[model samples]
Target: MEIITSGRLKNTIKYLRALFIIGLILSIFFMLGILGVLAYAKSQGAPPLAVPQTSLFYASDGSIIEESHRGQKRYWVPLSEMSPTIIDATISIEDRNFYRHNGFDYKRIAGAAIADIKAMAKVQGASTITQQYARNLFLEHDKTWSRKITEALYTVRLEINYSKKEILEGYLNTIYYGHGAYGIEAASKYYFGKSANELSLAESSMLAGIPKGPSRYSPYENLEKAKSRQKIILNSMVSNGYITKKEAEEVYQTNLAFFKSEDLGRERIAPYFQDAVKKELLTQTNIDEKTIEMGGLRVYTTLDPKLQKVAEEQVAKNVNPDSEIQLGFVAMDQYTGEVKALIGGRNYEESPFNRVTQAERQPGSTFKPFLYYAALENGFTPSTELRSEVTTFLYDDGNSKYTPHNFNNYYANGTITLAQALALSDNVFAVKTHVFIGENSLVNMAKKLGVTSDLVNVPSLALGTSTVRVIDMVNAYGVIGNGGQKITPVFIKKVVDHKGDVIYEAEQSKEQVLDPNLAFVTTHMMTGIFDAKLNDYTRVTGQTITNSLTRQYAGKTGSTKTDSWMIGYSPQLVAGIWTGYDRDERITLTAEKQYAKKIWADFMEEAHTGRNVTAFKPTEGVIGVYVNPDNGKLATNACPISRLTYYVKGTEPTEYCMDHVDHYEEVEEKQPEEDPDKDKGWFKKIFDWF
Candidate 1:
């Protein structure tokens, strides 16, 4: 019995020694932890923390298109602008003790811990409004202990530095309410279209409910769920002494009055122009954000809303399913180079291909105008003669010879004047003229006219064998309208940031592309193609063309084997149109007209409706003249019936063709009766004259 007692005492001593050793090790560990915390706290107190920078995008009209943070739509407003109802509702739902508690609400945290421990699942939340705001602004949404610790630290710091009002305002502005919205101002605009000051009690409650789960309570996402969540927020507001019970019940019974902003998330009519404008914005502003997240941006663009709508409607009406041809078009104010309209494709949903700015297709015979202009610039008058016969161009000694053909197989073997060649779009005539003018000179002429493509100096290029875009073509046509001055197309007029600062402005300038005399000669030649007196129909074939032409205007038509094209201009406007398969297939050909002319006609008609009907002022360098049809020179009685044409001052023909040089004479002009003297006069009608 004495030995057993001794062993028990020895065992007790051993146990006490082990406990002392363990306690010493734990104390050392605790000291190390405290030292580490003190060192970290000291380091943090002396430096500013690095945070992520946000990028922004703007429209041509200077509206914001996007901001950098995902699911964040912050439109910062001063605390003075915030509504009292919104303030109360937010505080009641987020944290009623926000005014009294420091960032770390020890009582709330202990209560949450107790509840979580009882439930055996992590289902409790202890974050105050200030804590949540700090986390949202500076910390990532991580469900880890380390992230929570950082959130608590930042919240404490924020409270120490800022007033309650400032902290509340920050909380209201930085919290997410879903649907890519961030701040109270943006949320108010998203759901109500107005400022936060305009929110009603019901609306405020509904917005307050969204912070917990945006998708679950979004009015656009689910109205029933949103209403349910709103009730919860109202009840919480009443319980937290934010509002009386009677007031809470009254507001809860009221349905939310939603405000939908017209400009906030809507797409523009001409997406191609918008896309081009956006790309320019990125290059100029160094903005790298995607377009979807851009809030309400007031984009002051160059697009004429009226013309763009007409172009869209025309494509929808004319591009039938059988043809499957898509259409692209662009219009611009000729004087200022402002783009009026742009249509990227038939529909943006089926394909987002921007045919107007990106697609490269052959210009076809429309290219003839440039070739003709090149000849005129190089001292060739309208009366310059060339044969319209089949001729073989040299390619290689062993290969089949290259022979250009006219649209119609028949041709005149004798000499044809330059005016006649252009009016008929004769392939052989243009190719021969290009050969004489030098390929480089012709290409330079095209480039001067605003053609942006890399053009090769090949024989086929005379017939527009080179590819070009609709925007470039429209601007090229504007060169003629500006009296030989070339202007770069302008889509964005100005870009202003959210703070109302103009960050960028469009640079508009014009440079002379050709001698005014040469441009006039080209314009004069084009006038013949659309002469009302020349067509069997006494009136113009298209109302768009007729209405746009009170004075001198110039334009040309083009058709590759598959696609059809038109680019033209008045003194005020330049427009281009193209119709072809999106996949580059031979779907539109022979007899049936494609969407090209229809879209062009429709867009122009609408664009010119309210605009001033003005004529192009004839420049001092040009002159009008009457000439015989058989020759581009002075007419004689022996010459066939004649029509009038114009020419540049020193470029008129000296004499008629040899066949009719001495046989014709000029005729005197005649005047019409001043009035119809019929019995339909007022006084005569009273007398019933028969």
Candidate 2:
């Protein structure tokens, strides 16, 4: 050792004293700064920290179909509801000295700082569970000195204001787990398809490993990385005395059943209907999108789960999965306008475009009822006769001509009654009626009956050239089904807040848009469509409506080159079905399988299984009378073909048919002014006498 002089010893001592004083002043200033931060945070008061809850959608039968939330899906639960294994695992991995610390783990922070300094980069985080909770709740996730100080002060406040158990519960509930899941409850359910209390040791370890770097250790994203993190968590658990080494090893070796992210919402019974309800919630209430996503409102809808299931099954049974055919089906209570079931597409997962509420397609002859209703609203009756021969209509300043033709080009080519025209779906008769009663009248009638789609004022409007949505079509038919009462289709029945207070409730609205007698008469005319032979107009020979259903219901069949529709209603339910390709390509439905009608019939038969078989009762001012089918005149004993037809009281036929006579004496007496069949040949004259 070298010998030290007195002057050098004195100088070294002075330098040591000066360094100690400087360190002492610096320590005092740091303590004062920390105190200032704590005081400021305390002045700011306790943070409003709560986990986001999931909003639930329930069917009319009180079964949950969907749980919707924004940003992250979270389900808050008490700490006692969590598996003890999860709590132990989380502690072992996140903050081993959590119970012993005040707010920050000073020893871990020091170690992490040293490690980060050695690496010459900020590669480590020293946030405890409480510190994380503070940052997640009150501070932005920015790696800045001011943010860190604010987080530390908030962490201290949280420790002072809450118990160790509360802080841990909050931290576990608010941490972001990968795959849009938050909280142990949601993560456990998402990963294991079970509640937190039912999570096994392996699942708990897996979830505990996710919080460190959720995306990095997401089993859905990287199975190997997640497994590595899980193994590390198991080792930590064993080292921290939570479990034995053998137990940890056994858990590490155990296979974990992971949930498929694709199947996250598979339990949702009717996603398209749920989507409709979600949209309606936004439109019908003052609830903002953010609040609706986060408020955990219980949306109660009028979706009859049984009917919805039937609708889905019927569509699946009828539509070929391999084919490009898509279908839209809607069923609703006729009087209440409550949508009981809705199938927007065959599979909502493949496409979420809801056809029922979104798609606007040509309604074809199914739109004839609105035209006929308009005619009846005017001074026309079912007994009114029109020539159903080929006719041409000029439009667009006579630049284009449209000649309507019946299916298979089969027309009566003579006088056909309104009832027969509708039953036969005679295109010429409908076009004549559309022209007789101006296009404005038909458009107005359609609007009043709930055809919300644009109805162009063209002659082809009689043929449903304009487009309309399935929901609007069902609602319009529901007008006739409900005996002339206009009803708005209602899906959501009620919505309640998390506290079970009624936030929104649907009220039934009804407007009498048509005369009850006219509606009844129109419905009766539609009933004739189901008849195998309408007096003389048979239903397309080999294609009879009788083959579709044997029920006492009224409906119309509509088809375009590419689209086919069957919308009908009994007094109880109104249902509509549409089938077509997604593209504008034609589809030739086979006679053996009329997909729309078959689907409708099957669903309707089941839907009416337990309900009463009530017939449509005619309202007052509506009367039935027999008329000659050939000439649409009052029937006489000599008339060969006669059928009973309904009419609005004052519109019934008053003149008897003069085509046939009972005897020669009656014929001569009735035709004294001219010889009967004078222009006939001698054989026909003798035949008339005989």
Candidate 3:
């Protein structure tokens, strides 16, 4: 009786233990199922899949300048546009049960699980087409269990949200292939030198094998290994009924010709300029950086391809190639402030530091125009005379002393007119005017003329001791060239997304900031910088480029110990050039000193080849008069150095120059010549003199 009771109690305890084990297993599964459902709920509002497309930069005439993609070099194509063979090969090799599975193929999973259990590790993949697409689109390629679980949940969401065709299309267009390619089309071109739609069955099968292991399966990397992978793909294609056994064997036996051209490599067109455009796209528009690189944005830029080519050629031909000297060049439309062409550095491959919009160097005499413009607004004329001799100033209640000197420590040592002062880049005249107009006036004028750089209110600021960007200086010069109507630099004219919807269009902003008449007079005065007649103890800064110019131009040249700048414009265009070392080494080379001027001259002349020569028009308040460029006095036949100068109507010189009277009379007695303009009409003579 005792033994029977003990056996019955033991059986009862065994039954209870079995019941607990079964209940625990069921509870674990139920919790896992709840977590899976929650994950699906979380993915219900997943952001739509965004396939990266190359952002194309188009020139004003619709020519492609660059195809900008941050990382993935994908040329997106819909599945309908893809070749049927590539599709079939891809489907066969990547997932055979693709069409029948909802998200997970239970049969493949069970087989993979059995294999993993046999090996006591997770190695075999049971991912279907939907599963692989979900992983590629969103998740990382880590093989951790948590990652696998997340990938599974995402797979479920993708299957529930999208159709099979959409999933396959996204997968084909977003997968990585060898040789910097990211999609089927790019891979086709990179490997076969043909479009995806034009690929044959043999080409398609070979490409279909690369994505599994790019370096291991790429024909470019290893032909034998790629062939082996290709054979497997073709066998699978035959098994899947995509091709007959004989067709598969024929494709496998064909000795395929590989693409060996360099034409399809990444194009580097104006790399520095493209950097600036990308920056502007992020800051100026409502678009994000990712969208600019991957949303297939069509950016219609103000770039002039002809001018861009000319700019590059000029820089390459004129700049000293063997030296460490760097240069920056930018050409902009004066009327609209459209940036036409840009070169940011000497060599883009060696260094990508953009000097045009990034580096800020001392502008030197290029800043003089702003000071002189302020003077013109404050009761100063082109004929206003100032002592150009070396001088010291006592500003700040005579506590601070500043001495300004011209290049090479040379000076006129006598009175020079404002026109001649600018022509020779007389430092004394510039500082004197800066003080007279108050130290802060030039800074204010620069700000109004589209200068965004910081400017210190000091006496040397008149001499351009303050550093400024080449783009800002060029933009300011555009204002002067466009009759004082200030316009900001415009890099992109409009932008359109991939859907053909206009995203951003630049609005041309023009504001009347300076007096039109005074601006015209200032512009005319600048032309004297190239006129040899204005030469004094110091030669005109732009005299070196004078012979190279074909059309009428108003220009200024600026120099410091380490920087050389040339900013100038015609009626149609404005440009700036800079040359110096990145470390600000003192310029001792003669060629380095003149590089900016030569490049500016070459680019401007060639860019304006077919364009009509347009002369600057003076307002009604301004009048053109022949004056002694040396003294700014009314011109007489006696004056040896005379030029057609513009001035506000009342500012015209009434007194004729008497210094050359006796000199000319002595010359007349020795040898008299007929007056070239004596028989011409007034307007005709003025035009001919110019």
Best by lDDT: 3
Winner on lDDT between 1 and 2 is 2
> Which window of ten consecutive residues has the lowest lDDT sum in model 2?
536-545
Tens-place lDDT digits, model 2, residues 1-690 = 988999999999999999999999999999998888778777877765564567778888887777787657877777898999999999999999999998889889999999999999988878898999998786388889999877888898888777899899888877988788888888887888888999889899999999888889989888899999999999999899999999988998898888755474467788888888878888988788766787757788999999988888877776776777888899999899899999988778899999999998988989999999999987888878898778899878899898988887877777888887887788899999998988799999999998888788989999899989999999999998788887998989998875458989998766788888889999988887776446555462214446656467888888888888988888889999988877867887584137888888889888888888787888888888888866778766677777888888878888777789755466345433775576899998888789
Q: How far is 543's C-alpha from truth in model 1 (Å)?
A: 12
Ranked by TM-score from best down, the candidates are 3, 1, 2
Residue 582 lDDT (model 1):
72
Model 1 lDDT, residue 8, Cα: 93
Candidate-wise lDDT, in order: 0.72, 0.84, 0.86
Candidate 3 at 343: error in angstroms? Answer: 4.2
- In TM-score terms, candidate 3 sits at 0.75
Question: For all the candidates, what are their Cα RMSDs to the real structure?
Answer: 10.6, 11.7, 8.7
Candidates in order, TM-scores: namely 0.72, 0.69, 0.75
Query: Taking the tens digit of each residue's C-alpha lDDT, what string does model 1 give over 237-314?
Result: 888887888888898788666766644567644667767776766776564544313433334567666666777776
Better of 1 and 3 by TM-score: 3
